[model samples]
Target: MSTVAANAPGAAGGGLEDVAASEASLRRFLHGLPGVDAVGLEARAATLGTRSIKTTAKAYAIDLAISMIDLTTLEGADTHGKVRALCTKGRNPDPTDPSAPRVAAICVYPDMVATAKAALAGTDIQVASVATAFPAGRVALPVKLADTADAVAAGADEIDMVIDRGAFLSGRYLDVFNEIVAVKQACRRADGTAAHLKVIFETGELQTYDNVRRASWLGMLAGADFIKTSTGKVAVNATPPVTLLMLEAVRDFRQQTGVQIGVKPAGGIKTTKDAMKYLVMVNETLGDDWLSPHWFRFGASSLLNDLLMQRQKLTTGRYSGPDYVTVD
Candidate 1:
């Protein structure tokens, strides 16, 4: 039972290799995690989605959602121009309204991290990079670890890394676990102040609510500062039900270890209404502490625009269009 909690912010454990002295112990630890009742999970999310918020509450939720966005551009054809523009957008989402809160960070490919960092200078907005071969994670371990180190070197304030779903699906659980540990270590800067890490599970491919739950615990145990739901590359991404389940995981993890890991729901969440539903889930499940940008985030690109528009409507009492908001 002597666990090594590598990457666990303040956890008391030995090291990565000691967490599970044997494969059998790792399996026992993962399997012993509480099971997910898919039906109940989905039903609870639906019920939380039904909670009504009036004008003031809606406006507050809109602003909170804005602050929680990791304004992202992770396309194959992404460029410095795109990353810089996204950084500008993240810093001042609403040009007409300076009252608008800035997003938590600008998310980009590892190569674009410096561009984003330069563009967002003097602002608290962080520059995050997606590494570890990103969306696919089919590359070799050395390649993945180098990918993470390169991002950290480029001044990424945070790293969003994808787990090797291939290994996880193949039942190489320790491979997946050790990979997270290595990537977390890669986040450390020479100053010893490391970039925060968010581990993506690609829940859609995992194919079951139970798998998502297990992945959540696994990431937490591996020392992920945040557990992310998806990469937005997949067809099914960031559903309210899946996100709600993740919120539950963070809440439970905090209760057990006293380490409050963050949660992020990436992809397909496009509207302020959709964002509010997630906020409701957080408020209900994890309470006010996790409601801020520090503890929660929306790994989104388009979600920022929608939130801006809604914030405009709440301010001016009229709906706005694409013309008013900057197109990233």
Candidate 2:
């Protein structure tokens, strides 16, 4: 499958007509979706109450995707180091204590992917890059595909691409779907170790729960390995309610397709408590199968400090200084 042909506008084999039909089904499904009423809130609360403190914490360690706008900034360096340190195995400076959970990957821009990859070399941590004009995702198809290819060639283990939400919202659902399928196809490596594709829906821009659900299903059907929430570029990013909607979409998709796709709620996740809430949602909505790093991920830069603080409190029964535990 040549990248050019895969993304060509209205290329033969399957054209916009198929996408229009899929969109019609999606719209019908969305219109038929039940409203967010009191019953739904109660059920969600009940599910949250069942999660254990330990399981929630374990989920936190799975993956932390950090986005750095400027690699030269001190804040960016600090965030990167913290992620690298968390992914380290075995004992830290505190020999008596066991190492913390490994972070699945460190996310950054294309130029910085190599730096993160080098820092995380010889470890289980992966290097991920946001390609195809992230956040807005308004660029041309060929440009986006080439950007993805360049990032992967530079050692990015995972490629996070934003869907053309404008097209989907404007009723051009198939265009967005085909773009993702083509981008995923372009991620192949020389040795056949292709980079994983995470399709960002930017849920904040999607407006309604119905739209979110439809976009989730469309992305999965179009071959997205993971469906992520926001680009963190907007004021409102990942929220509990929106995440709840997306979780239901992935769960329902799994039932129908028998393929388990990953879910990442990125942007604006700040504290350990916030991360824990997401973990609770995943546990309740998706169950134990999607509990590991392979199935779930959190994308944030400030979240690591809070998680570490909470872990220290759990271990020593006292609050400790930032220096006591080294950040990556």
Candidate 3:
């Protein structure tokens, strides 16, 4: 856990007093965030993406990326059987190597939290669920909170909630902010310990770098332990540049607030090369503090297979094929 109190709305030196004060105050704080220069941001991400990592460093990063994956299966056709298999995959990504590290968590829809919890019990892996009308935050606040509470009650370690982009883009910034606060509260378990809250911005719908930046701040101020890039249901999800911008948000948020929030870029990232680029971006932008699974995550399902293949190639002198890795 971070030093910043998750429930402390206005802790001294937390840099959240003004943001939590009022809707008007929040608007000012968000608007005051520096505007993003699109071209420059893209250039920086591209430059970092071009970094060449080989041999030992590449092997370490492959394992690190595997550990950072939140192996997900969020389909409407999801079943307990499929979730159980996915849980197995998350626990033992490479049967060929017992030394292979397990994934950080198994991400599924709210209803599958119990199934995943049962399947992944007695392991270090966590169970994360998507709530708040996931992919589309178009539901009543009560319903959303109930969805979140259900997941927590079912033993979810993390709750990924979607913000009302309709409310946010329509200038109802306080509504969006308060909704996040409410959902964060809903993540609390009966034991008083709460599931980590990851607020999804759905940046593709937000449409501008400036809006992404503002939404990042909005989520952090609203007490999200992590601010995710997308729900992965959007037309465009986790681009390198967007992920770069979010990394910047977390970095700046920590610098100002002393709160160490995490960043997860979901949806489109695939391939060991793609994961490496993101690692490079984090290594350069946020330094090593954000390098762990505690502070960064790659929300991917197929990306894990590629990472496993890369790991196998590193272990053996020969390249491995998809048939070698388990299919889940």
> Over 4 Å off in model 1, which ranges?
1-19
- Cα error of candidate 3 at position 82, Å: 0.5
lDDT of 3 by residue, 1-328 (tens): 1212353333324556766577788788788888899999999999998999999999999999999999999998999999999999999898888999999999999889999999988898989999998989788999999999999999889999999999999878989888988888888877788888898999999999999999988888778888899999989999999999999988887887788888999998889999999999999999999898988998998999988888888888777865888775
Task: Please report the candidate that would top lDDT against the real structure.
Answer: 3
* Ranking of candidates on TM-score, top first: 3, 1, 2
lDDT for 322 (candidate 3): 50
Q: State the TM-score for model 1.
A: 0.94
* CA deviation > 4 Å runs, candidate 3: 1-15
lDDT of 3 at 76: 84
What overall lDDT, based on C-alpha atoms, would model 3 receive against the true structure? 0.87
Candidate 2: 10-residue stretch with minimal lDDT: 65-74
Overall lDDT per candidate, in order of appearance: 0.84, 0.67, 0.87
What TM-score do all the candidates reach, one by one? 0.94, 0.78, 0.96
Candidate 2 residue-wise lDDT, 69-99, digit = tens = 1111113344655534443421132333446
Could you say which candidate leads in TM-score?
3
